[model samples]
Target: MQKIAFQNELTISTVQQRNGANNTKKDVRKIQSWLTLFAMTNAGAATATGIDGDFGKATEQAVKNFQKAKGIPQNGIVDQATFDLLAAPMRAAFLSTITGTDLRGLVVSAARQHVLNRPFELVISQQPNSGPWVRAYMDGNEGREWLWCMGFVQTILDQAASVVGKDFKQLMPLTYSCDVVGTTGLQTGVLFRYNQIRLNPALMKPGDIFLLQKTPNDWVHAGLITHIGDDFIETIEGNTNDGGSNNGNAVLSRVRNFRKSKLDVFSIEGLV
Candidate 1:
């Protein structure tokens, strides 16, 4: 087994400590510079060029040049991979920080918050059937005509992944059982019968993918698990029915103690 590097751990701890500190802009800039230095060292770039976090002309040029060489969009910003290259230790640190902080709740909470701000459209066109565009429009002040629950889920997962820096693809699968559809599984008094089996609510930790399955369909909607309470699991969903007038938008809603809901709960734990 590969030994965990102490330097990597230390770097992440330092970043966390700095983030926790209520520093002024100047101090924050200083910390950023230090981060850049750390990234440079790990990347094995020459130290002849001073390590500065300013993202100045030289850094910007370097980033653009690197992007061109790698066939990535030359936007000059250090994206995830570029960031990883510059600061492998920091990436390790970031993952450690999340794991150590018991950040599962944070992830769930963040996802919930994103959902509340929902109805946002996704930039990619491939997921049109997923209803991201409809979700985006719904989240907007003006609602649209069509809404697709599956599309809504995709947008939320995408946003959650960006915030948490984890590949959600690795943690969750886009599959729902066919048997758990409408009114068959659980009964809620005389009212709503359990209908859909979305992303496995049981297997969810912070940042895990939560999905919504339409009746008869295997996999439909998607979201990120932001919070998991004893009884309730809050989600940031998109492209939902918002009453009559403001319908067809992305919105965040809580799936109260999802396990208790009349709906059948299927977890993607083993699948992930």
Candidate 2:
């Protein structure tokens, strides 16, 4: 699939500035491209009418059509609310009655499907259910490449939850931000943050998550705990390569130092 071409990446500050009536001609074009790609597949007249950075009648109408479909206000402007609404992509098939009685086991079972080092070509640009690994994860959501770690974890939770007829959101909050996951887990009485979990080889369990930290309050990477030992912990993490760059391109099952790495741990009991 052809990527949405742009000179630079969209940042939170830029996104905030581009919303509503504050949008410039350039902002409008970006919005037009994103909306058309998200809701209408970027072809035909499905909001695909604008690329000239002009919020003309066609752009306005396209925004309105997107708003109408999303059940948001039918204002022909790109507001923050509208931008937020466009973030969610479609979900793939929903499987009911998971055969695994164990929640953590189910998560591991579902996670085993995607291989490490798999490329983005198979993951991006496809119909809801058609794409293999990436499409299956993140509820078949798409966009903003390189943020697949959270999606990978979320997909495991979803697949495991589906087996037991439980809503995935109810089991665990899904988010791209590790801090958000940590915060939500604490608020919901479902997760123990880094210092609280009391991690040791004996204390850790399978299917629990480890949040590798960037700061005490900010977490940068996360992965499932598959095994624990005296000196190291085994993990299945997404977006990590053999060199252990947290921002790498693929999922990997790697071993980490037991005590030296800065990290946070969460129990699976809260999710189960």
- TM per candidate comes to 0.34, 0.55
RMSD of 1: 15.8
lDDT (Cα) of model 1: 0.37
CA RMSD for every model?
Answer: 15.8, 12.7
> Model 1 over residues 1-272: C-alpha lDDT tens digits?
01122122222222211223532333223233333343333364321222322435564555555456456786655433554444443333223322224334444544444443223332122332222134232232112323444334433343334454555334333312222222221222111223332243344454444434345334344444556776666555554434311123335564544654433333323222
Q: lDDT of all the models against the reference?
A: 0.37, 0.58
Extract clashing residue pairs from model 2.
20-78, 98-163
Q: Which stretches in model 2 have alpha-carbon errors above 4 Å?
A: 1-99, 116-132, 139-146, 193-199
lDDT of 1 at 185: 19
Candidate 1 matches the true fold with a TM-score of: 0.34
- How big is the positional error of residue 241 in model 1, measured in Å on the Cα after superposition? 3.7
Off by over 4 Å in 1: 1-106, 116-148, 162-165, 171-225, 228-231, 242-247, 257-272
